[model samples]
Target: MLVSKKIPWVIKYRPRKIDELVNQDDAKALVKAWLRSWESGKPEKKAALFYGPPGSGKTSMVEAICREYGYQLVEMNASDYRRASDIERVAKVASLQKGLFASKRLILLDEVDGVSGVADEGAIEAILDLIETTKNPVVMTANDPWDVRLRPVRDKSLLVEFKRLTKTEVLNLLKKICLNEKLICDEEALKFIAEKSEGDLRSAINDLEAVAEGAGKITLDLVKQILRARDRVLEPFEVVRNILRSNYVWQAKQNASQTDLAPDELMQWINENLPLQITDPEDLWRAYEALSKADVYMGRIVKSGSWDLLAYATELMSAGVALSIVNDVKSKYRWVKYQFPSKIRLMTQTKEARALRDTIAELIGRQVHASKQKVINYVLPYVRIIFDNNPEMAAKIAVGLNLTDSMVRYLTQRNADAVLNYVRELRKAISEEVKASKPSKTSSGTSPPTKGKGKSTQTKEKEGRGLDAFFKKT
Candidate 1:
């Protein structure tokens, strides 16, 4: 039997005009102003970055604006944006204004955060270049624009943040889809789907189509039976809720199997919410005991490289910890607001500073002849003290250690430029002294004790060694 293809509801009912967009009046206004500014020959920012959670209308709004406003849209998805050559070519094509009949172009780079690995830096540079030169209005979309690699683009862009839709917003959109399709949908059924979708309009519409495709009437019971969480990727909160709400062991395990998070990451999530979820002391202890066992399993897996043990670890973490609420079943289903794992949050907050600190440690370690960790633990303290108290001496140490601008900034903070200025002066004085020390050409226009390039290279090496020895003594 052949089944006829039909357009997906998300694609068919996509917002085509400005007013059709659900929320984000602020973002829309900013984008409109930015586009208008481009018309006058120069805008404050050449690009706009739209970032938020999925289905928040970043890409959709861009498309809708182009459709209604008469600008031609040139879109690139995640895969297409990785190649720098391709990005350059597209930017070049966008720069073309061949004739009076040519329409203004809008270039959309969707999912800019997904680029990773060796080519990621190059990809970012390409995007930055594209923003600088492209005559067309350039826009980039990301789910999370705060990714450290995207920082360059974020600085150069007009940041417009979109927010997740409210449940009422999702419900209204679903009702509209139901009305357009002429499918009889109960209010309860629509509400149930909207609540499960958690703010994503595309998911809500897709869920609506899933249930109302063949069924003449959509009811609460039918929606419950067919519209399962397994139909889409569940968020972390949804994953936790589903696991804790499970009646049977397999049901709890089933929920764990659906998420994209790794086992350890999921454990952190469960551990964070367990205390809030369970009030009873005994139950809380039991839940943590199960998490501890899962942690042990993970540690063992890491040490032995026995990946076959992952199922046991996952089982202990998800089903084991979830079913620990045996005594007070009510606590398991309590409406406690879950939190992001605090430990991960702390790590994210400190990552850049930690990386910079380690870089300084490496720079000093190379000079002092020690390991990076050793320098961090034993020597960096003294180096920091010198940087804080003495500018001239710190500059000498910086020159000897061969530290970068960022490294110096890490140590001295607001005083970095003062120390760098001293370093520059020291280098200038050293250059003048070296020039005076060099052998001047003889009266016959012949160099003195010179062996061509070999002597020049040896002389440079000798000067470098002398400076290193001089700094070490100082």
Candidate 2:
């Protein structure tokens, strides 16, 4: 038989068993207890789960246990090798198999915690069935075990938690690997790796490999260079905090936008965290004033198609905010969550109302032989008076204008009574306008209004008619 190919560094270096894994005493004890149950030939635990952060050797330890126990390995990843048929087929064979190569077969389920939805629903059910009936012990691994669906499996299985690697553990591992590889590195380099790894041993090892590749001696400078480039972008939260602590408003403002964050999002970040940064009463007011100005300009740009004006608004928000902080005392800050402006939410609601109102206005204009703009500006404004004087007229106008109760209320000003009255009158006015404006046989023969010379003549005739009508009515 062909020999299995050598595993890659990432896989080969994976921690094989709880005992071999670093810095997880609690998880090791639980695994040992499970293994002891098997070693004693007592009914082996149905399942054992390894759960923790990524690169923490959870999978490696399980594999190591299988190897140490002389058990044949059947490994499947839930992410890729997952399907109802595949799971059922595997379970069927695994259940029937007496042993592999004269050793007991161990089924390893990877990322079982990810099982969910209709796609994996069958797979989950199959696994649950296997857990109940399977002879061979099953080992599953997951980054997070707190998922709701996993609760059943978790309760049935022995749960072992793997924590993030400690700094000391990461450092020791880094040093051990470096020594093995014949690479020379300083304590600072090791610390950098440990710190950058953030308790991820796999990341630390990978980073060390990257730094040590083709190197003579690993210096702190080299480590810094590598670490700096591999670094994640600075969080906008930190930038906001720094700006808040800055003495110079321009400096703080300048740094705020310099962060690789969107200006609009940056504004939100600043706004959310401003209170935390600027604690003084007066300073808070000043900061809000700047924010309000920024918001106004932002609104203007949206309304007017003037994208070029965004910069001024951004600068106003950033710099103006920077000036709002009272003191320049630098201090540590916790992360603050940003929120969307409530006014903006209200404005969005208002826009919907306005659109519906406009549609109604347009329909009314069509029926009344009046422009929509004129109806909206001139006629709707008088709806309240019409409602109080004549309810029938108002109802007719409502039917004519196609006004919804909500829109009528909204256009009727703020109060409920005013809204109802205005709505009634508006409807009546629209209906009357539509009826009066309906072209008579004589009016139907008239030509359309014209521009320039004809417009002037039309204007004069209209004015003269209005004057004569006003005098005659008086």
Candidate 3:
């Protein structure tokens, strides 16, 4: 007798035919068009880059195509091919050859954007080189196609985009999975799970499996217990809506725990949308008063380093602000579209620029032996002035201070390229001077130093001889 193996619902229910995929008609149609283009021996674009949110079926859809069309699927994880040599050694073989068992092959490099840092710059080039020579189709996927690192591949390949599945789509998929598994799952429970997933179908399936494990039936209470304990990256809009709409104190408090946002960040979100939710002036005043108290708690936490105050802060922010809508309770239940905090938006917009400024300050601080703030306010302005006015002088300072190319660029935007080139020339000249002044190789391979120490001092400094001298003195 043979026992059957249990498979994950995600894999077990993966679409084997193109038609099985839902809510992706455009992507499917695009893929099918490309597949048909293969009939002429080659398509206009030899490669396709699929990009979208996770569990949007980027990889699974490719698998379906290969299974349905009788083409062999050769899957490669992007992490593995990090170097040019790694790609050449592995992907090259997969790309140029027909599958041993099938007439055609599809080479998939999954999560191309996840290749990581400057280390994989060569791997990207190698992939481009592979595409030029391969007789087969090369497909890559990423959560973000706009990443600067993927710019080359973006230009070189056909781009196919996928969107996060809708709540309705996820619900239908869950219903189908429950039916197939013959699991007695409550409809409300399934809907709650789908809502929690935020359109991540893969996570929703896994969530369902988790809740159903070792149980004859799944219930709303069971889902709530498990999912609440499992934190997710919740959108501020969802979190604030849930918290503000919650009727009871515990419910509002529980809803606050749904997001992974920092307490202060979440505070900004709540503060921004509070006015939109509470219309009456008196009710709005009450909400703001509670929010201000929460802000007080935050300041205390920062000043006194009392983390225990965080619970009170969270309570005030979530439950306190929420329950303050007592003057006109009907406004609390009204549907209001929320906006992200303008404060947070400005911070986000300036974050990279601030980081660059801080990095430049830190570099300068190392040479000047000053605090980063002091250097930023006092020293950087002068450096910027020198960079703009005196190219040669600026290059010397850049080299002397060991500032990187980006740091120099940060100092002066207009003269960045020229200053960088001058800095490079200075470096080359210094390197050659050091080389020429290294003193021609000695006439003798090994010679006694004509330098500092006397013979007795030298003997004492020598390793094994020190012990002998100690014995002689004794």
Candidate 4:
């Protein structure tokens, strides 16, 4: 047995008159007056523009007007024709040619705003000129009317603004169509489509078409699938919630790493949300302490270029952290709001200033043959002055040292600024420290300054050298 495709009720029985159209009662009344003027042997505005959000029935209005006034329609999107000659051809045909059966002609321009730039400019200008003097009743539709380029058209035509359809109007229309077509869809499914449409009837119809095509009846699951296709990637919060709600530590770990977040961001999400999930304060502290150790491992991995360490770090933060929790019962948790890490934000702004300061400090430490730490303590104050003038140098140092935004700010010693200033200061301090600690540099340059006594200088310098040697050994 064969079956014929079922036509949707919305399309099978579209309105043919202004009075029959759903919503836009005011626009219908205004269109009615225009029709009456033509009926009584008087010419109203020869051209009118319909401006509104998509699927608000601008095209439908034009067709209704034609049916009411006994006029044949000539419709086209302005974007399709690229040349001035093409538009002129259309204008000539519409103006000179008689309607196939009716006495009058109705020209409908869809998406008139799309006509623009080098290719369509001539064609668009021609159309506007056609509107100014054309004999037919012209109806133009566009999303926006305040576009400065459309100002001339506004001067030449009457503009009617159509609003987005209300929820009640969309619901009523959907209900009417469903009844007429004998389609069986749950109220929730229909309402879901209507809300998702955002007042766009075409979108609603398309959704209806898809659902009907899949099965005779539409279900809520189908609607959810269609609506949420773009959100496939697992969210970190969902992962954490599932983990905290689970009974087994290994299961929780597996669930947490299933999300799209990397180890670092994942750590922050866990840190912020873990306390809310664990009821016991002692358990929460233990979990946090384990996470902190995992973070230390993560830092080591980054510095030493050892990727094998990531698994250990991840395990510590996930399974280890979860085990630290005393209870494993599932329950609701207060949502942790996402926030930018202050340190990261600062790095972005003051990277350059920080780098330069670090470079200079490293060089000074090398020259003195002393420890990087001693050089930083003694030389950073002087280098900070450079930040007042050379912020980029300071920022560069900050980047090299991996200073957080707050640390950057602390380095600059200025609280009232774009936070970038702080980043620059910190970068300089860190880079200088790294350079001073290099293997080739002697311990003498990094040594600390002494008191008024020459003995103090010698003693501090020797202590600085000892510190540098210790760091090198580590």
For this target, which candidate reaches the highest lDDT against the unseen true structure? 3
Candidate 4's C-alpha lDDT? 0.67
Better of 3 and 4 by lDDT: 3
lDDT, candidate 4, 1-474, per-residue tens: 133346553455567987777788878877777656656766567667788887888887888888877888888774454466877888657866778888888888776664432123576577777876676777788876776666777777777878899777787787776775578888898898899888978677767766766576777888788656533556776776766554334456667667787787788777777766676676777788889999999899988989999988888888667656543222224454544444555765778766755655664575466677677888777656655556665655444343456555555665325447555454455446656667576555563553222233453444344334334433
Task: Give the 10-residue window scoring lowest on summed lDDT in candidate 4.
Answer: 326-335
Compared with the true structure, what per-residue lDDT tens digits does model 2 show for residues 1-474?
123223334564666654778888898788878877866777556888889887788877877787777778787775333466777787657865877474687788887754531134566677887788877778889877887767788888888888988899989977877786678889998898899788878778878777876785888899888767765456776677666654343445556655786666667777776776556676688789988898888888888979998978876787677655433222213355544545455657788877876876775565466898898987666775665556545544554344567655554444446546655654455445534655453442263543222224554343333333333333
lDDT of 1 at 411: 88
Each prediction's TM-score against the native?
Answer: 0.51, 0.49, 0.50, 0.49
By how many angstroms RMSD does model 1 differ from the true structure?
28.8
Cα shift from native, residue 303, model 4 (Å): 24
- Ranked candidates (lDDT, high to low): 3, 1, 2, 4
lDDT of 2 at 271: 75
Regions of candidate 1 where Cα sits further than 4 Å from its true position: 1-5, 96-102, 116-118, 229-297, 300-474
TM-score of 2: 0.49
Error of 2 at 378 (Å): 18
Q: What is the lDDT of residue 260 in candidate 3?
A: 83
Q: What is the alpha-carbon lDDT of model 2 when measured against the actual structure?
A: 0.67
lDDT of each: 0.78, 0.67, 0.79, 0.67
